[model samples]
Target: MSLSAPVLAFEENSGLDTAESAASCALKLVRHDALSKADLSAIEQLAHQPAARHSGNVFFAPRAVAASASLSRGSIDWLLWFQDGRLCLAAPVVISRIASFSLVRIWTHTYAPLGTPLADKRLRPDLLFEELADRGFSALACPLLETGSTLATAVALPGGRQDGRAGFWSGIAERAVLTSDWTEAAALSAQRKKKLRKMQRTLPLVHRVLRGDAARDEGFRQFCELEAMGWKGAAGSALKQSDTALAYASELVASHGAQDTLAIDSLEDPQRQGNQSVAMVISFEIAGRGVVWKIGHNTDYDAVSPGYQVILAASRRFAAENTPIWIDSLAGPEHPLVGWLWPQRLTVGTLVVPLKGSHAPARTLSGFYQAEARLRQVARALRQRLRR
Candidate 1:
């Protein structure tokens, strides 16, 4: 699973040839520690500034914190910096090996929804993918990518096709821009404005979103309780109680806190008196990018649309800061929330590549793909039947 010298050379040699002026920047692969604290801080600061692209929780800074926390089990080999002296590129080439397999996977450190190339929007993926292939990674998976991202546009598989799925989902805010003024943002869209007005009118009826203090030990407990009482518990879902899952959540929050951008918003109302906490949405601010992680709402409060209000409130608050940020709902297109929030799509998918000179790896990948295809077919059929 180790990165060979040839692979590293291939990645370094692949450079962007896009027509954009920003594409002229030379791409460099350096050890994770190559980024000086001052340089990292500068990038962090610039990422938070207005008009900065790809500044979110999953960039280099947060990754540094998360890695230091010892929570991430995977190894972080290098930080891919595509820079031109002053302007910095934020995409880090994270290398990790799959268990029970000899294949190594390379990806943009995009574990969360906010993960994106922290470079100029003009950054090209063709060069990045070429470098990734040259690095000899068996697969390049970019999870939770924004739908219209330049990286997504640039990446092409060996067969000259993109490998990923794009969709929306319910219970989360879609990709959206928070304006400089909350009031102005409220008026930006007539539909959104109308919904906000309605929610505001209904706010008197036991509806309010509360931000919890992560410093308090009870913060995680309260979040878990609300999440359990909402959906996970009733469904007996493993995500509610899984230590691995909880660790990931805690890690992301801690990482965000280190960057001074971690936020937890919970929906509470007296009318929904069964449980004080109806819905909880966890968001991380990394270098100014706002990414909504896990969101859960009590089924009991679903009738009143409490989740939507909480999201709206959070969005308004973010907009008031005048920071260029994106709130990702991180759900499939068919999600109920997509209907109301109308956040733009953030497409994401797992990229799988069969290992060369290894019939075993290729065979294993083929079986996995076949199984996945079957599952997708079944899901599609089920969905079509449900539509009837």
Candidate 2:
């Protein structure tokens, strides 16, 4: 924490619609290394707050962000929103230079499914964009924002039709989500469920939701090792393929688990001598929201659908625990298994919002962004098809 860093002050009213004096509040750009303990606490509180619009997530939580920072390719910076001289919203972003343009985007790992700004209930997204623009930024690049979120809806809509929305926006996409209800747990066809049940009876499967350090460590290790031995290994994209990626993931799990917010759900064959795990799922729950982060299964158990069984185990746990919000699938939108099994779905996408404007600049910037976004989507589709 840098006590000597100059405080960057703004003359405008706090972007937060808090009851406090709409008096002047400051916006400070504090580098990760300079974040104070107080700032980190504020972020955690906002993320844990049920009333916060798009801020309720574990990805941007202090320890998670810090762990991600260690493995990130860009420098981490925090943008704080203050109201009545108190921190109201925060966005941790990675600032970089792209083709003579300064790109400020949400600080999220490739696997992070949400880019929600850590914000107060009434915090406005445009306020942050305007602040960035005043600091010479052209726009804010936010990726993986939820489709139905107020801010995301405005960004995805043509022409920023909503009042006080982003000046311009682009790139809308959809992701899968499963409602945390027992009703949603059996969305698969009756025949498929019957097959899974029969496989379970034959395998004598033991479902475990590991939360303790020792147990979770072992289970997560099993998961990473399993993933590495499968297709991800062939693709050279498994966590164990990169020392740093694996270490960072371990740290992230440990950090979140310390708060009782992480779990490793697994299915093991109790009939086997060593009780070997056949499948595993890494999940994080903060307050009411749950995220199904990763899944891995032993190919040897494909006939039993170990992967699906473990997923079902996780879903049942979430429902029994009464998880308030839906669980993000984190799997691709086109993912066959989870997408077919989980009836509910949500959209998420990468988008850039032109800073503080309504007319010519917004139109030109948004049009260019939409065109680029289409190209990127086409490239991604081609890659997927090629891989298939």
Candidate 3:
């Protein structure tokens, strides 16, 4: 598919009755390198909207994503969604293969856990699907979507319900997200609580949040160094493991810092020889919302559970604020530590949206989803058994 033209146009449904119906929508296909300065500005504004910000996704931000695409060495193709005669959403997608099926899907990488697109408002997925179907697409495979989010609701499968497009009540289950009111899961054991209490008192801590260029840079260095001192480094998965990963992280920090959305919070051990940081967390603020992006700890301080401590402390502070706010852990539901401490969860899932008039492919993919879920469950069981 050549990237030079608009694929489809539709009547934008702006609420005002007097609004001109001539305001039309076009799903423009643009490559990353082809994006103009004006286009970047528009996308930066789009990142401020709920679909991106509420999910704590900085990846959809213009500068941040450009950095990502450059380093990931992948094709960066974007479908710019225009609704109400205005740019409503922007997301990179690929018509690629999955189990012998060539499907249109939200482009994703290992580092990007959530595949939610950057949308200014709720978009009608049904309309988008019909348009794609008309354009020869079979289905849209959306993975890692927050089940209750704007993009998810727009694309969730309709079960012939009363409200056919109610995504708040639909979608397949994929993962769990930790939200503000996160204390909803079953309580931890008394013994476990007592152990954690003991761990907290083990280190006399000075919790600090670093901003500004100099301090934030130093904090980032500390984080990478600490992470490299542990299993992540040995496993070749730490930020310092590869120059490309390091550059990507650096670019993200710089981009978010310029937007006043980046912060490095750490818990320093005052009693340590030189007041070393025991745990560090790199986080991004999306307006009032927050995302805990990366965390690292001094394995020597494992007895104190420094990583979890800093995160919980941050969560407590968030909850203590007068204004209501939510933060995403950015960890998968299978993550042991995050789910245990933060009990409230956001149901995330993959949706297979069958393009209009092309029902077979979507049906096949739906069956594939079921089988994949079963396999994943079995894999988890095997892991548990191995651990035991």
lDDT of model number 2: 0.68
Q: TM-score, each model?
A: 0.60, 0.83, 0.79
Better structure of 1 and 3 per lDDT: 3
| lDDT of each residue in 223-313, candidate 1, tens digit only | 6777787545765642457665666566555555665566666666666544476666666554455556666677665656767766665
- Runs in model 3 deviating more than 4 A are 1-23, 50-56, 70-74, 97-102, 155-159, 162-178, 182-197, 212-216, 271-275, 332-334, 366-388
N/CA/C clash count, model 1: 15
Which candidate number would show the highest TM-score if scored against the true structure? Answer: 2
Tens digit per residue, CA lDDT, model 2, 121-162: 555444545667778765576666665654554233354234
lDDT of 3: 0.64
- Return the candidate ranking by lDDT, descending: 2, 3, 1
What is the alpha-carbon lDDT for the whole of candidate 1? 0.49
Model 3 residue 102 lDDT? 54
Checking candidate 2 for backbone clashes, the offending pairs are none
